[model samples]
Target chain A: MKSNTYKEYIAPVVVLVCICLVVTAALALVYGVTDPIIKKNSKATADKTRTELLKDADSFTEYKGKLVVEQPGAVYVKDVYVANNKAGFVATCVTKSFGGALTMMVGVDKEGKVTGVKVTNHADTPGLGTKDFEAGYLSQYKGIGELKATNVKDDGQIKFITGASVSGSAVHYGVYAALHQYKDMGGVK
Target chain B: MGKQSRLRILLNGLIKENPVLVLVLGTCPTLAVTTSVENGVGMGVSAMAVLVCSNIVISLLRNVIPDKVRIPCYIVVIAGFVTIVQLLLQAYVPALYASLGLFIPLIVVNCIILGRAEMFANKNTIFDSALDGIGMGLGFTFALFLMGSMRELLGNGTWLGIHVFDKFIPGMGIFNLAPGGFFSYAVIMAAVTYFAAKKGAK
Candidate 1:
């Protein structure tokens, strides 16, 4: 019985712990080698998306001053990039969609016109809320320089995606927040 | 196992005992990713890398791993490989990485990886275990591709996001949704099961 106990319990536990330690060491080495590459790739993608959203801008420079967010409620400006030649400003923004947070970059021109918007990260439900990030839904925001970002339900002229009011509203609020930051930083001038 | 039987062991994973169809394992990732062909391929290839690596490692350590703690030991090795694969994906193929997104990390929990590790890898030689991983992985990829192509063609009127059909009439929108995912999965599952049973009867 004592031998059985040793074999069944203590033996397995010892073997398993040794295996775990070895695996963990191996993983640490692989992670060390790959982590820098991963960091570089993330930066590359972020750069690519930022450039795509502000295509017409001659160049972009980071805006470090405080961004006044006129629109409150789940909207936030994570970073602001201003285009050279007073062209436009791109705001890396985030807001809550139906399923979760939607992170995007919104480019607004000096005339307060939206040049482009690209969703960088989102956890919205695939079919239900993610459709909001597609070209058809996002195109509505582009060049809608007239009204301050207001929900279409409030008669702001922009039509929210059908059956996905929360997701649509998230983008609307993100754009609204971006514009307020742009104005505060002399982007419209 | 003889050379011919060894060949049979590898072939077993591809169709006769396909992880996705015959065994009907790891159906969630299969269904969720088949919305688009690209996503399916990305998920399949990633899982394949992790599976092959983990399988070989487990097989090598099979004797050393005690039976009582085998499950935990297998999990640690599998998860380690998965994290490495994910890191590689994130670093090198950022596009594929983005498309696969949350599913990449979720691959750690995928039953097929641990299932193969426990069933085939621990019992087999290193070369055979590696072959099993490759065959199972390919079978999974093939199944996912078929489901993705059918769904994409019907649901979006596109193949790999290219608008191939429905220039006029819209495609079946339902195929892209959750219910559509289930219907597609069930239809394919039924087809495979039926054919396998027929072969058995014959």
Candidate 2:
């Protein structure tokens, strides 16, 4: 009876509970240290992208007022930055992409031409829709006077990624939305 | 019950019991990350670290773990090692952490780690268990690297994002797609099978 109680009831539970306690304690200790580093890494990446978007500008001053954009497929106009040297304005924007959401920075120069578009954060299908996020595709927005949805299939200039059309559309749409906000802020020039 | 040579135990996992090619385990990650050479190597090294650590831990505790709850205990232990690996990757190698995002967490469920713990670690000495983990991990790494190289070279005409073919011919776009991944995997699997069969015939 003692052996049965020890083997059947007490011992297995004790082992499992002990293992769980050790693992949980270990994970808690690790998370405490890594959380801060992860936060810093993400912040550094964001700062780098913002800088890239407005590379020529000496400084970028974010508009400290409420931003509300009621455009289709546009998530939000998260922030608007004006170049201190008056060279350009970069609007950080977000839109729903394939897997989750794509956040990008669209830079418009003094000529009202899109100087650059950079995808800052995204959770899209890796190879399919992600192809559109590449510089080759994103760079197509550079120097364009107006943000237009272009797909080679429709005889327009740009070609939507073959397999991930929805994701491709989302990125272009997000950039266009950011451009619209830039235009609202006195037409980039 | 009898003694097994350490070298034979180590070599057994490389080919005879290769986690990917022969044992046909952990195919999910093998396919998912093998899309690029860098990703494949990153994942392989990360998994190997977890595997070796878990093997040693499990072997050391083999006697104390109650038989009835050994599987659960093994999972908790493996998961601990996996989380540590993930945290280290995220903290120090954020580039790899970003590229391997989901796969890094998914290593917790990877059959190679759990299988080694159950089949080898629980029954073997710590040193031998570590060897098995390494051999199997390397074999898995080799299989993934070959797949990634073939796919990258053919699909993108590049190696590790550098232009390799230099417009010799436009890349076969399909190789970068899911169908391409499956096709390349099938080709590799067939080759491994064929060579293994020929060796067996001798």
The most accurate candidate by TM-score is: 1
Worst 10 residues of 2 chain B by lDDT: B1-10
Candidate 2 B-chain TM-score = 0.89
Q: What are the runs in model 1 whose C-alpha is more than 4 Å off?
A: A1-6, A68-75, A97-101, A123-131, A135-137, A146-172, A183-189, B99-102
lDDT per residue, candidate 2, A35-153, as tens digits?
99988997788667767876788877777765647454557778888888888888888887776767888887877788888887776535556778888888887887764452234
Q: Which residue ranges in model 2 land beyond 4 Å of their true spot?
A: A68-74, A110-112, A123-129, A148-157, A183-189, B1-4, B95-102, B162-166
* Candidate 1 lDDT by residue in tens digits, A32-105: 98899887876677777767877877777788789655435456898887877667778888887775778888
lDDT against the true structure, per candidate, is 0.80, 0.79
DockQ of each: 0.52, 0.48
Query: For each predicted model, how many residue pairs clash, with residues at least 3 apart or on different chains?
Result: 0, 0
Give per-model TM-scores. 0.85, 0.84
Clashing pairs in 2: none
Give the per-residue Cα lDDT of candidate 1 at A137: 81
